[model samples]
Target chain A: MSEITPEEHTQDTRPAKHSGERYFGWTSHPKAGLYTFIFVGVLAVGLALADFFVHRHEYIHLAEFKIFYALFGFAAFGGVVLSGWPLRKLLGRPENYYEPEEETDNG
Target chain B: MGDTLMSLLSHTNPGFIVILAGMLAYVIRGEIPRAVVTIGGPLLGLAALVLHSALSEPLATLNMMDMTFVLYQVERVSIVFGLAFLIAATVNSIFALHNKDPLQDSMALIYAGAAIAATFAGDLITVFVFWELTAVSSVFLILKSGTPEAYKASMRYLGIQILSGVLLLMGATFIMGEYGTLEFDAFISEGEGLSLQDDPGAIFLFVALGIKAAFPLLHNWLQDSYSKATHTGAVVLSAFTTKLAVYALWRFFPGEDSLIWIGAIMTVFPVFFAVIENDLRKVLAYSLNNQVGFMVCAIGIGTPLALNGAAAHAFAHIIYKGLLFMSMGAVMYRVGTTKATELGGLYRTMPFTAIFCIIGAASISAFPLFSGFVAKSLTMSAVGYEHMTIIWMMLLFASAGVLEHSGIKIPFFAFFAHDSGKRPKEAPFNMLLAMGIASFFCIWIGFPFLGGTEFLYGLLPYRDEAMVYLEQSLWTTDHVLTQMQLLVFAALAFIVLNRVKLYPPEKRGVVLDFDWVYRRPLYHALVWTGAVWSKAGPAMTGAALRLSRRVYNRIEATFSPQGELSRGPLSAGMAIWTSIVLAIVMVLALIVGPH
Candidate 1:
């Protein structure tokens, strides 16, 4: 069976370029909270990097526990992504897994 | 003699609740019996608990032919679990008032009573008897759905559950053979957590309890049956079975090192499944697995602090999870679907129920002001203090995952996701009320200033830290902000992913897990085995029978009356008398040996 391509995931073909909800009771913020989030994200990532370098005794090497976690993280992320494929159908049930049929249960 | 009779009348056992429930099932037309059993049976249990606990003397031991076992033990942990169970049974009964199915109500009560009875059991043998009672009573709730799948799933569920019970008995029997006593306290060996070295029967019992607790790969029966049970059935099932296993673990396998890793894995594996799962109930089943994982990990930690954490988490989870189930049950009652894809915009109508669902979500997510926040922090701190960095990180990861699946996805998808345009009516008043009470627990337990939080901490394994933890660090601004940061970022990820069309939408097919091995392939394997058995096993036996008959016919012709063994009175009488004497000897030996 054919799978939906990632290219088709985005729906960018709108007549108007719409802005999100109004910010600070003035104008719509097309990029509101975007930079703030990015800044926080970068700082967090940088901190993680700094910790890895700073704590070389703990970080330069893969701890036994980290191996399990890295493995799990990859496995879980892959499971989610691959689930979108027809592979999911192998286990998926119809929405009516337990529904009583109208005619059968009806008096 | 009069006092003895009075004691016996009020005491709890496997027989009274089930037989009474069976009678109640026979009499009540619909909701009344369920209401009575759900609400009234617990009060009966509390009275029984009082009777047993207050008996002044130690619980009377009973010796039945071969096995010697205590009728009850009123220890502190057992008391807490029993009280929690009593409360759960009552709450469950209330939550189930909207259910019109009597069989569900009856079976639920029997199930609850079995759990309580098992908790009070002071010996392995007594626990085993009531343990299987739990299995037998619960299968009906799954079967009560009256669908073919429910029938099939419940049968598989019953088979696995009964197998676990038999395993427990096998372990108990072995323990008795080794120790010459059936009391639970006398189990001589404790495995090194998951190791096979420390005890023979302990590992078997651990695996059996692990099966009930939904540990890792052995946990398929939960998702298999919980996903298929009736709306009320799911709630009833959630409260006891797994928690009982956690209790068993605490009692028997505390300090076994293997549990730590196993519990960590248990906590993590279900999040991905919960995130992608389409069935709302199944998602909760995964979430339930995740919650149980926390308890299992704590039990594995095996410190008093950790054990208390496990007990506390089980207590808090039963209510909030039931509340979650109640809210979902309301939705299912009104609209007849628990699929996330088919549900949305329900808050506008079922506002009260929706609010309850949100409360459940928040409590489970360990939001700073919920029951989960308090109970869960103990385990996290325990692991941290022990310097198990990996476990600590895994738990933190799981906390974020919990936020994604339970805290956000549950309420977000079911109540506030893209509108499905189905304007179902508000859930029944009783259902909403059940949700309301559950929500109250989530709040009451979370507020540290409130004595409820302090009281829970007081009951911890490390009571010395109870006051200290509450005052100093439990609600530190830095800690709260860090937790919020993690949870909020995870929520942000889910939102961004959803908005960008990257979040996995609820799909129309089953996600294969360990259950797929059993439900689809093994189920079909068993069917194939049945076909093979019908075709091959009996036919082979039949052919052998025919060949034996032919040989016997030839011999009979030579003997003129019968086969060689039956030929003469001299031989026959001797054989018969010998067999008779042997049977008598065995019977007399058993009768004369014990008691």
Candidate 2:
């Protein structure tokens, strides 16, 4: 096994000199995000439509309503993700927040 | 002689054999020999577990200090957790094949062995022994990172773990005092465990297990240590400690009521923390907390189906979570950090790791046809059966939360988000093989008719309940469609959020957690107290010394013979008065004293 020094580890993050090789380049295309969003939107709509046709035998009464899970999932996930903005503002610290400064100062 | 040897092997605790192999690995010189012992030990333990004679009975016992210690007992629950541990140990050894650190190899095996041993222990004393051993042995993995940060984190980790072990010992002592024996069979019966309210020891045991299980507020050691451990060390560390706690919880406090709320809170709180976290491994640490919450909740429900759910989820979680950690470990191996801000577009080079990571993400997210879906269904149904609507809703909300951080964020930011232009090489072959094996189990157990679910369900404590659940509810149209609806909408929400710029971008920072209360305020308080003592201690001591000296000088001036009494020669009047006083004292003594 080869040992990776800290210097080498930092250096590895830089773009490789031999940059010709590429795999899964399509994922980097300009419109990939748009395409992904459209695909997921279509799937969500389709699933919602399927919910009306399928009978849900639910233990909780509110879940029997059509597209309840769809709404709940979308709202719950979005709520959690959007909460990140305030969570970060409230809790975020510098990358070196926890590092002991005395050691570095003495050295 | 052959028959005797076989009998010894059959009756011996598989963990001891694995521990012996670990000791052998320490002295072994060659790489191949060490690797053989490291990987082969767990395999041999699995064989021993299979060959053990019976369930719910002690296969081996020892008489010590006028007490019988049941050292090796195979129960249905034990087999589920033990098999998973042995498999994980082997997989972890394979994953670490490239790193030839002998100490790590030995300690990893020993840590794993101790957990398995504790799982099979029928008496609390035996459990306490291996419990501390697991804590002592596993700290070496974190120390192998060899960074100041890793050192600090490992010490904190060790402290918390040892505290948990101390609590367990205290609880065991209480049990021994209350009951004449400490054996599970003697005190706790088959289906029912000790009640937290009814027994003093149960509360101690609950808190002890809660700490190890990373119950809500007591969970910082996990995120702190796991993110700092060596890449391979994180993978090994993830497999044992908390799962052992869960096994203990199941053994001792299956139906405790407070665990229901504790587990619910455990599931929801980490999701919020994980969302804003930058380090991908730390995100997974939170995700691990969330996943375990489901099992904890299931155990709290404590019906046959729920217990089965807990066991089945643990078995599946040990594999998929290990796979996730292994994938990240591979990333750390080539890239040196798992922070999301420092990683992206590596899927171009490390495609195999990306695929395996996605599989693991999907499994953890409880996608249809995944191990998590099959395992978690029983718990959900059991909760529903009990009509615990509020708790069920909390779990449902947490399920979507799992999809956000683990299912989407891990793979997205690390592999497919905006290109960071990093082109590190693909993971080593051994790592890929380990991940491949784990991925196989995820799909095999998750998909129907592969005999994987059957095998897993068979190992569950309540096989009948699990089998019934598998047949009646698992693949039902409503269940499948609703799950699909939940997951699809959740994925759609992610897309929508990203499109609308609502999704938070990965940044370089640490998110503050409960650890900050200690790492900041408590730490500063101690430091301040020390500084005050350093400044004031000598002053206080000098003042005390000066006061004592002043008193001594005063005594010498006033009462010493040279200072007062002998300064003047005895006057005649004084001598006459002294004689008169002496005569009066003699007369009083003679009058008052018994003749």
CAPRI-style class, candidate 2:
acceptable
> Model 2: residues >4 Å from true position, as ranges?
A1-23, A101-107, B542-595
Please report the TM-score between candidate 2 and the true structure: 0.90
C-alpha lDDT of all candidate models, in order: 0.73, 0.90
Deviation in Å, model 2, residue B306 alpha carbon:
0.9
Question: What tens digits encode model 1's per-residue C-alpha lDDT throughout B1-595?
Answer: 9788558745554334543664485467856655665577676666666566342223656888886767766655676677677777777777777666677777888888788778767788888888898999999889988887788789879998998998898887777777888775565222223234766777788778988988899888898899788888898899889988887887787777888998999888888777768888888989999999888888788776677778788878888888888788888888898888888766666666777888899899898889998889778877866778788777877887787778877887787666677667777777776777777778988886777887777655456765676787678754564455555555555545654677667776566788666555665677678779988998899999999999988878765546566667866797889999999999999999987
Best by TM-score: 2
Candidate 1 chain B superposition, TM-score: 0.86
lDDT of 1 at B31: 61
Candidate 1 clashing pairs, residues 3+ apart or interchain? A91-B510, A92-B509, A92-B510, A93-B510, B193-B256, B193-B257
- Predicted candidate 2 versus true structure: per-residue lDDT over B97-215, tens digit per residue: 99988899899999999999999999999999999998899899999899888888899999999999898888989999999899999888655888877777888888889999999
State the weakest 10-residue window (summed lDDT) of model 2 chain B.
B563-572
Off by over 4 Å in 1: A1-107, B1-37, B47-57, B60-63, B188-198, B465-468, B526-595
Error of 1 at B283 (Å): 0.3
In candidate 2, list every pair of residues with a backbone clash.
Answer: none
